[model samples]
Target: IYTGVYADGVNQANRRKSRHEQSFVAPEWGWAWPMNRRILYNRASADPEGRPWSERKAYVWWDADAQQWTGEDVPDFEKTKPPSYRAPAGADGVEAIEGIDPFIMQGDGKGALYAPQGLVDGPMPTHYEPVESPFRNQLYGQQANPTRVEYRRDDNPMNPAPPEEHVDVFPFVFTTSRLTEHHTAGGMSRYLEHLAELQPEMFVEVSPALAAERGLEHMGWCHVVTARSVVEGRVLVTERLRPLKVEGRTVHQVWMPYHWGSGGLVKGDSANDLFGITLDPNVLIQESKVGTCDVQPGRRPTGAAMRQYVEEYTSRAGVTDAEYPPIVTVSDDIVTASEDTGTQEEEDDE
Candidate 1:
């Protein structure tokens, strides 16, 4: 019912066209979702009376002569439904929707600045610090999102955050992304000669200031250390990775492409190894895109030494085996409680 192209013949016809000068929507070129409607809520392109807001920008509008909605693309609304048509009192389902209502999914069929439901965090958007960061949240008393998901396991150790001591141990910020030359995890692209040639080895990009501070030389080998694992990459001292001034402190950021891995022909340390598995509470997506780590010049230790190297940093940073950082950190009471618990544990050990 959504895409009207039903058979192989219809699908072929939709895909045959190369270009159309008349309309950019190209309804005939290829099918779109929701009964082949190209633009969702295209009804909003016109005024309440179903007239185009501007002739040049004309999209879907009501055809008074045909007494139905007509447009370059399929009408999102019931085709026969006129603009003036209003639902009577106590109407149910689609019948309850008014003629002026463009957002059919919403209860009131209107855009909402604040959602009434269907959100785990809250209605309005609020800024919360990342699960791991070098700085404390400056705006609110809360350091990070209280509703964020945390995997409190031995393997997925978390770096220290604000209100916790030794956050400076992992002082630099690192983020991971993709490079166009290689596909995700380099599964297909890495084996191919051409693609592998484009990005021969994994590399980390750092700002000039960070390079100077860390004594990193361009094209030299360096390793990024986190509580989880250490991954080394060839140093690329570039201005693309900028140093930002936050809270009157110059903060440096490191960036790497998460394409290369051990299995790939163009093998290098995987940037993903540097991240811990923290997730958004709502969607459960791993928040591994950004985190904090320490950058050191040279390759990371291998085998048993790698484990010890990571543990050394965690120990120095005071990262405990206690449950992931307390969810609600806005109150001093919670911090005090956590400290008290830590003190009691130390006493018990004594």
Candidate 2:
């Protein structure tokens, strides 16, 4: 009851003895996951010679003379087996497990640093920009994740091109999260009056600085857009959501809870409608949890006007169909975009 690790009370082998020796005396041994193993890799508690590291920190140890396992808990190692014991060549099953090695599940009975196989992409990880990003890769020439499973269906469209080639129209960084009062997608929590009352409606959290620039009113209606879709929610101007000064530019961000959906009792637009299908390479999990978007004050355009709204932004921002950045690096100096523009204009005038 004290520790949530075990279903029942710990071992009560001896009233005067420590808790370690009482593991078996419980109403039942660990009834939790991983076969009730109180502690994983218990064999490591003992040295390679099968003796405890210190008298005070003694745990699982192999009793050589008695030829048995003795400890405060069940030993994760083979009973009566000494650390000197090594499996013979061509040994199978448990016989193949070396007495000195604690991690038996591994192929070599050791931890892996570089994976030899099983990974679809390269074994090592590299930095790649997301499917939608306002900046290019600062370290390498790789603009976006080459291995990501990108999709462009009729239902699921894409956003702007790589940062170096095309200027992104969706300037602000947008992401989705869940509120404490509501459950995921508002399936169970929205129907409950108690939970629904806390968060009465869907809203977007914006920095007070961004709110001033966009002229958004507190608790006023605001629309967010992407190449895929547009969604509207109430504006929540808060100081907590502040702008980030990245590369000498004040980059604003939009945050919204994804709990609301059309099916809920408090029906509202789903934040998921903003982006199309883009998935992690190994797991194939969609990046719907977060993506980039554009925000505007007032309600979203309807019918034919919506298409025109998107097309106009695309034309203004020059959304090219370039898959990757043409030039690897933008400039030699570590200057801001504002300074770079100033220098370019001076050169043009000269």
Candidate 3:
């Protein structure tokens, strides 16, 4: 911004000066930073005919007779360019750009509901069921995101997500998020006394119903397990993390902060470890926010016991001999709330 506006050559003589200090700078940042734009896409606040869309929201526009783009703010478009101007056929470089188009970076020189390029998945937005869900997609037969990439390795073994028999064993939905007191992973903040004092321990947030069902006490120890790993955290029984009714079944969700690690000044467990490797096609982003896990009321095992404990879960969950949920279409009979209640809901009585 400094280079674009207050560069070496743009002194008072070279640029037009503001009449008053009030007009020159914002009160929040009292220091006058020359040519600082308060808004982006200021051109959109006006109409293509060079008029404000409305008097209440006037921004940049063109004055055709003067043949200049003028407004309260400096023009993003070429100053001298008029609205009627059009780029010639096969014009390369800047000449290829259009006057009315505010977002020139786009291939169509306009906003797109569908991407023309750079989307690894597809051009248009399509709804895919979450990688882990208690319910199935009703609109289509496909139970989960078919495009989602799951990794299979000795170190990063994934859980049976959906359309699989064993998925029913690890019943609760879990999501990892941040707390107000610390930043993500808490690499630096956890070591500090002030911030760590505010949120002292790594804990899991659960609803009253979930706590009652699992026999978890407020501030008591609990183990959160996934196919990859097991993590122990203090259970925090809170009304904030409520259970939702999905497909006629009361589905419970647990919340945990990802700020903890196996090693720290305020050590507990790395909540991130409780996840398998699943990547988004385009960005290769893991669906880190939500997954499935069974919350047990007790501390997690260590070393060899930990491996045996995980095997016990997998063995109970019917993960025998490298079994995984295949990409498949689900029948409505197996996935309605009434039939899916605690299991699969067949039909709605209502």
Q: Report RMSD for candidate 3.
A: 9.3
Worst lDDT run of 10 residues, candidate 1, spans 7-16
Instruction: Give a tens-digit lDDT track for model 1, residues 38-77.
Output: 7887778888888889989888899999999988777777
Question: In model 1, where do residues sit more than 4 Å from their true spots?
Answer: 1-110, 333-350
Best by lDDT: 1
Best to worst by lDDT, what's the order? Answer: 1, 3, 2
Clashes of 3: 10
What is each predicted model's overall lDDT from 0 to 1?
0.84, 0.73, 0.74
lDDT of 2 at 110: 49
In candidate 2, how many Å is residue 325 off?
Answer: 9.1
For model 3, residues 1-350, the per-residue Cα lDDT tens digits are 34444344444224544455444323223222444555555666767777889886677788877888777766666677666668899886667667776665655456666886878666877677677666677767776666777775676665666566677777889989898888889988888888888888889999999999999999899999887788989999988988998888888999999997755567768889887777888788886468889998989889999999988988787765565667555666755643559543334443
Displacement of the residue 23 alpha carbon in candidate 2, Å: 17
lDDT of 2 by residue, 157-222 (tens): 556645444445778888888899998889899899888888878898999998999999999999
Question: Candidate order by TM-score, highest to lowest?
Answer: 1, 3, 2
Query: Could you estimate the TM-score for every candidate?
Result: 0.77, 0.66, 0.74
- Once model 1 is optimally superposed onto the true structure by TM-score, how far is the C-alpha of residue 63 displaced, in angstroms? 4.4
- For model 3, the stretches where C-alpha displacement exceeds 4 angstroms are 1-45, 50-85, 91-97, 328-350
